[model samples]
Target: MLIKWSKDLEIGVPFVDADHKVLINLLNQVDDCITEQEETTVLGSVLEALVSYTEYHFTREEKLMELAGYPSIDEHKNVHQKLFHKVRAIYHSFAADRESVQVDDVRSFLQSWLTSHILVEDVKYRSTCIDKSEAAKQAGMVPFINTNGTHVPFNEWGFLRVLLVDDNPNFGKLVSTILKAVGISNIEVTQTPSEGLALMSRRPADVVLCDWVMDEMSGTQFAAKMGEMEIPSKIVMLTGYSIDTLQTKVSSPNISAYLEKPINAHNLLDTITRTAFNG
Candidate 1:
């Protein structure tokens, strides 16, 4: 089914409404490609394009809402983030194995999501915010550009520095790479827990994502040390074990969250966001 935009989809914001039209066109293209039995590569690229453009549009919309001092901005942002995570998960699934998800299923999901979002979600901000032209001027004044050149969901979190401590060098690099993918540029990684401690003593990180089972010093040991030193960085323990087992081992109040590896990108972002906001 082709997703076509109508006047009802307009949120009284020209640029936002225009971007909605472009999104509709992209979703329609994906639907058309699915009906035509296009190659997996062709469909994947369209899905990727849709994801990229959707993120850009959401960022701009959020910026406008913030500029206008929209009352429900946080809720609106939460909705955007949930949808973004869903679409990104789908895209990653397809990228890993195209056959895992059918193109028609993705097309259907996109059609339903875009239509409902524009009609119901976008409409919420129509009468609340200033005119789109004024919003555009304000948005242009401060483009929410990421310092690392990757688009992250939170504008306030771009400056957060992350320190990754793992005994395995490859594991440290892998985690660092994943963090960077989500626009986390200011990262310091060390394979030894002692090095991590020394680094934090000199220049503390905003968040410490450490391996639970390190050889030199375990994650729990490091957390204990941090607690003794009164370092206030949010510690996120990355463990392969279950929470039940992990809790028994290292139940420090200093450890903010536990992420079971392999760490999901969305969950990592959410954990860091919550940790920072709470801290």
Candidate 2:
């Protein structure tokens, strides 16, 4: 583990604390990639996820600081900017030449930066009174929700095994990249409905994200096959069509949710968590 989370490291702000915990988990995942000497693509995905979430979290924090009327918001953002740029530099360097990047150096830098920032810098905001926007003041900004309208815990994301089926290899790659970028480690991409079905027969995925429109067969047909086979997988339909207009055509109960493409990390994760986990 890169860092062990404790109360002492928290800022006592609900949303911030929650975000920190998720960040810690991602950091540990990054450490795992480094230690295992994982493939460049896997490391890149993890780093992309870490970098993406870090940027978003920083934006959220800065907004909260503004809402709280914190005097040092500018200074805090400067600190954030510097750190963000540094991380980005590391990511880009890896992307440019994976072999040239020193894994140990990356590990040590992230480990220190995350722990010290949380314990020393973030601690300053714990007691800062942000009496307005109770929703934003709490963990409401967590940006993850299931069909039941309950927030999905960010830590549970790593446990998910996602299988994606889309005819387009490029689109499949894009979706798998988004999945990995959201900290989902176990993902398999299949190009055809038959391949997806065959693979699921051998090993059922926790969730199957299938494109709505396939060349050989439609997503509904795929879902129907899975339903008939009693494959215990949540089917999240990915389509370019309007959700309201498209949802009407879906008859299979296996399809738990429908997402309009093009997809991003937040919407994709939200849909998966909402459907697959039943929470």
Candidate 3:
């Protein structure tokens, strides 16, 4: 089913409303691609477009919120960041194995995710911004200018030393590529749990992206041990396993976030940023 934009989704912001229209159209295109059983590349391309456009829309929307001095801006920004990460994870997993994931599933997921945010979360900003505008009009207050860049550049993540723990070299390389794309250059890829431990012992990372199933030990065990050792590094689980099983294993507080594979650039960076900086 295709998602249709309705007036109920509008937040009384012209630019934001326009961006939402484009996002809805892009999601509909993805639904069409799934219906047509388009090639994997085609589907992946559409998902990439959606991620890129979402980032753009979010940057602009956040700027508008900042200008209006919205009281819940931090909470709203967190929601936006999490939604993008969730969407990217779903698309990346679908792109990896299109046969297992149906078009209807993707369509339903996107529709619910997008519509819920618009109606529930975004609606909170509507009355606040409208009231601010009216008050400014009455008091003759000038509009705030966007002097600082609204979009946060990826260079901010460069200082983070990330340790990637996975048995598969290819998966490690893929994650390295994604990290580099987000301007994270200080990365140490270790194929075994012992190697990862050694690297951490020598120089602790700001963030550690670890796989669930490993040769010597599982990612869950490593995270539990790390917790016992009380390492300061934020640990993010990277796995294709069942989330239910993953949840049962990660009772320890060391695991900061669990992301599904094959991971996309947007989600990996978002998870890292949320784990390392937001905390």
The top-ranked prediction according to TM-score is 2
Backbone N/Cα/C clashes per model? 0, 1, 0
The lDDT ranking, best first, is 2, 1, 3
What TM-score does candidate 1 reach?
0.49
Looking at model 1, residue 218 earns an lDDT score of 89
lDDT of 1 by residue, 139-226 (tens): 5444323333333454455688899887755455444544554457889989889989999998889899988988888899999999
Model 3 lDDT tens row, 1-279: 387777778776665675677678667656655655433443565576678667766776676667777789999999999999988887778767777776677778887887798888888878766556543333222211122232234456668799999886545655564565445789999898888887888788999989888879999889877777677788898777666778776756777788876455466666777788777
Error of 1 at 18 (Å): 1.4
Q: Model 2, 186-229: lDDT tens per residue?
A: 89998799989999999898899998889989998999999888
Candidate 1 Cα deviation (angstroms), residue 30: 1.1
RMSD of each: 11.9, 9.1, 12.7
Report the number of the highest-lDDT candidate: 2
- Predicted candidate 2, C-alpha RMSD: 9.1
Per-model TM-score versus the true fold:
0.49, 0.59, 0.49
